[model samples]
Target: MATPSSPFSFLDDLFNRIGERLQPPAWAVHEIQHRAVLFLNHVLQQEPEAQQRLLRQQGRVVRFQWRFVTMEMVATPAGLLDLAPAGSVPELTLTVTDESPFELARATLRGGKPSVQIIGDVQLAAEVNWLVDHVRWDVEDDLARLVGDVPAHTIANGARRVVDALRQFVGGRKPPQAGGPSTGSASTAE
Candidate 1:
């Protein structure tokens, strides 16, 4: 017989099946870390490239990457991490730490964007707007919580603005674009 479908029905059945069996939330201080490798898979669908990047197994490790975007997770005592290419090691790196993926994605744009601190000085609060212009995370909800102490709003707005600017830049460039260091594609660590 075909089962009757309702929006809440699946949830009700799920609760009935596992609510009593599930354990309470764990208080483990996970030091999550992982490597985000970049380079288009050529396939519209991408898959994991290595064992070091698996985030859910244990400890404090979480890595994600796609296209030219990449990140490396180094677990901390608290908060979360949003992965993105900031600069380079010899360069710099940008990260967003917040309560959830949604918060990070939203703050990845706008003026008061997260502080892109290079060394103790160089700060790029507006850098997130740059990421958005290049289609960094695909959508707002697709981001991951890399564990850190980051306010949500800044990341959200910064990402939004970056995407807007990137669209304009690409549309105007239309390939065959020649330039210098200031005009080259962003470099990411895999």
Candidate 2:
């Protein structure tokens, strides 16, 4: 007798097939890389120290990749990032080691770092690590600029709550109590 097929397995296979078939065009990829650089620079601009670090690494190329998508960026003396030529050799390359997009998204939503494999210069890797740890996008500030401060604050708080809920669901654990340690196990004392 043949076993019944799992719906989840079938759905996973279908999604993989669709993803493979829907590869973005080269122009679209380039545009996306450009926009990503712009966003990174915007964040870096907020942190003067980050900009100084990037300025020190000026002219060095760093390639960032996740699965099939790759972008090569060069640090400028102005502390901004520019999209490097596709053919240019990078001094450092950072490849996302995790294959599961869902896991990556979950980690990001929980404010956790995604796993990455670093190749090439150690100094560049250190600089990159420092930037990652220090620089953060000021989403609330940006929203406040577009909308009113009160609405932006409200939206930011709502988003934080949703993220907390998602983290609890995905991690199968309640958020740690403020000023208290997390106990992953369920225990009771009478």
The models' CA-based lDDT, in order, is 0.35, 0.87
Model 2 lDDT-worst window of ten = 3-12
Name the lDDT value of residue 126 in candidate 2: 97
**Residue-by-residue lDDT tens digits, candidate 1, 93-116:** 444433233233345432234433
The TM-score of candidate 2 is 0.84
If scored against the real structure, what TM-score would every candidate get? Answer: 0.20, 0.84
Which one is best on lDDT?
Answer: 2
> What does candidate 2's lDDT look like per residue over 1-190, in tens digits?
6553543555546667887899988889888888888989888899999999999999999998887778899999899899997689999999998765666777887678999999999999999999999898989999999998999999999998988898888778877788697558868999
Candidate 1: 10-residue stretch with minimal lDDT: 35-44
Clashing pairs in 2: none
